[model samples]
Target: MNTRTVDARGLEPPEPFERAMEAIADLAPGGEFILLLDRMPQPLLRMLDRDGYRHDARFREDGAVEIRIGRP
Candidate 1:
């Protein structure tokens, strides 16, 4: 499966979210999107849930987050 990655670590509010939204929009069917962040992206997770998108988030011991997002 093809995968697109967006590293949004250390970015302030809205930029990370915006970049994520853009990357998610451009994902092809059956493709996956990986997002790296410094903190948990609650809003993104919530939106994904509300929109019924397939996604999973993993939290590292170092306080980083990796989210894998897929098409609904």
Candidate 2:
């Protein structure tokens, strides 16, 4: 499967969310959207949940959050 990475680590609010939304819209079946964020994106997570997308979030050693989203 192909994985599209969106680096939102230094980005401000709304930008990260917008980028994530764009990635989700462009995601294909059996593919993944990897979002690198500076903090836990709670709002984004909620949106993903409401949109019927499955996702997982993990913290990196440097304190960045990595959110992986995919279709069920």
Top of the candidates by TM-score: 2
Please write out the lDDT profile of model 1 over residues 1-72, one tens digit for every residue. 457789999999989999999988887776788899998888889999998789999997878799999886
Model 2: per-residue Cα lDDT over 6-61, one tens digit each: 99878877898888888888877767888999999888889889988889999999
- CA-lDDT, candidates in order: 0.87, 0.86
RMSD to the hidden true structure, all candidates: 1.3, 1.2
Cα error, candidate 1, residue 30 (Å)? 1.8
Q: Please give each candidate's TM-score.
A: 0.88, 0.89
Q: What's the lDDT for residue 72 in model 2?
A: 65
Q: Tally clashing residue pairs in candidate 2.
A: 0
Clashes of 1: 0
Which candidate ranks first by lDDT, i.e. highest? Answer: 1
After superposing all C-alphas onto the true structure, candidate 1 shows an RMSD in angstroms of: 1.3
For every model shown, the clashing-pair count is 0, 0
